[model samples]
Target: MDNFLQVLLDGVLNGLVYALVAAGLSLIWGVMDVINFAHGEFLMVGMYVSYWLGFILKIDPLFSWVAAGLFLFILGAVTYKIIIRNSLGKSGMAPLLATFGLSMVLKNFCMNRFTPNFRLLSGTILEGKTLSFGGAIISVPQLVTALFALVVLSLLYWMLKKTRLGWAIQATAMDKEAAELMGIKTENIFLLVFGIGGACVGITGGLMTSYLAVYPEVGGLFSLIAFVVVALGGFGSIPGALLAALLIGLVESFSGFYIAAVVKYVAVFAVYLAVILLRPRGLFGW
Candidate 1:
């Protein structure tokens, strides 16, 4: 029972991270109708940004997260304005192909610059701290990351529910043509949403770097998981994404413990398939 509880708690912690990543993916898809294949690359960019700031600039990893997120936000906005905007109406294969090309470019660029070697960011903040609750042991970094995720998720929820720009985003997502007819600048909204989405990915990347190794291919792995998350939660559904992320996180944690570690992802995939089979639109999809 103790082991089970520990695994469950760990799963929830990991799920929160996955939720953060999935939220960004869902936001971009919901608002812009463009699936960003480079979503993970944005994460990779964040990790690298935090890595440099923490290692070279001698900044705290937490502080570096803010810097990385802001930088990625700008990057995302620019990418949207320069590349995504051009492929707005041409959604069939052009955007997909273009983004795929962009992903390849990012991968190669990272490979050239950072290489495929794994990198770790070391700092006093994240070393040698653990919290024990009953039989469960939680690390300080994981706790901080989870708390950060909760705070950010709450703020995002509030923004979407209570703010004007949030309303614009929702309206645009619901009906782009109608939103434009109602004087909403759909293009600008897309840009903002893309930026915000990227910012989320950036933050996730920074947080992940504290716990996971940094590699050029890290983005691709996370991107694939994000895709599954979005699909499992329902495309363009924020709440759905959160819920799905939690589910996947828990499954991954428990499966890895009771089953084979290599099969954890397979378990997640199976869950996704089962959910899709049962509800084609997704659990919380409208």
Candidate 2:
């Protein structure tokens, strides 16, 4: 029973982090209908930003994450103005290809600049700390990351549901022509949405630095899992992302424990396949 509880707790914490990572991708997909193949690179950059800040200034990730988020926000907005804007409304796979190319550029840039070696952060505020409950032991950094993720997600929900900007975002997403007719600047909305999405992943990367190693290729697996979470949760649905993330987290955790660690991801993809096969529209997709 204790072991079961430990696995369950681990799964939930991992799920929350996954949720935060997927939220930005979900928002971008929902609002712009643009699949950002470079989304993972955005995360990689943010991790680097956090790592450099800590290494140079001795600042903790708790504070450096804000800088990472801000940097990624600007990067996202710039990418939109330069690359994505040109591909908008174009026929064929221009938008998709544009992002894919951007992803390649960012990945190789990191490889050349940062090298392929993995870097781990140490001596941060939450490093080497743990909390024990009953028989289960939880890492402090993981707990903080999970709690902060939940808070950020809740705030995002409130922004979308209670703010005028949220209404404008939704309207633009639903029909760009109609939103433009109603005096909503669809272009500005798209820029902001992209920036917000970037910030989401950026913050996630910063938080994860306390516990995970950073590398050029680190985002690849996470990117794939995030794509699954966004599709499974229904594109553009925050609640859906959270639900799907938790489900995947649990499946991965339990399978790694009971089956084989190497095959845990196979179980995750199997569940994703089964769910999509049954409901092609996704759990919450319209």
**Can you write out model 1's per-residue Cα lDDT over 150-261, one digit (the tens) per residue?**
7777777778889999999999999999999999998889889989998988888887777677888888777888888898888877778888888999999999999988
Cand. 2 Cα-lDDT: 0.91
TM-score each candidate: 0.96, 0.98
lDDT for position 60 in model 1: 66
| TM-score of structure candidate 2 | 0.98
Q: Which ranges in model 2 have alpha carbons more than 4 Å from their true place?
A: none
For model 2 the local lDDT of residue 116 reads 92
- The candidate maximizing lDDT is 2
Per-model lDDT: 0.85, 0.91
When summed lDDT is taken over every stretch of 10 residues in candidate 2, the lowest stretch is 87-96
Candidate 1 local Cα displacement, residue 23, angstroms: 0.9
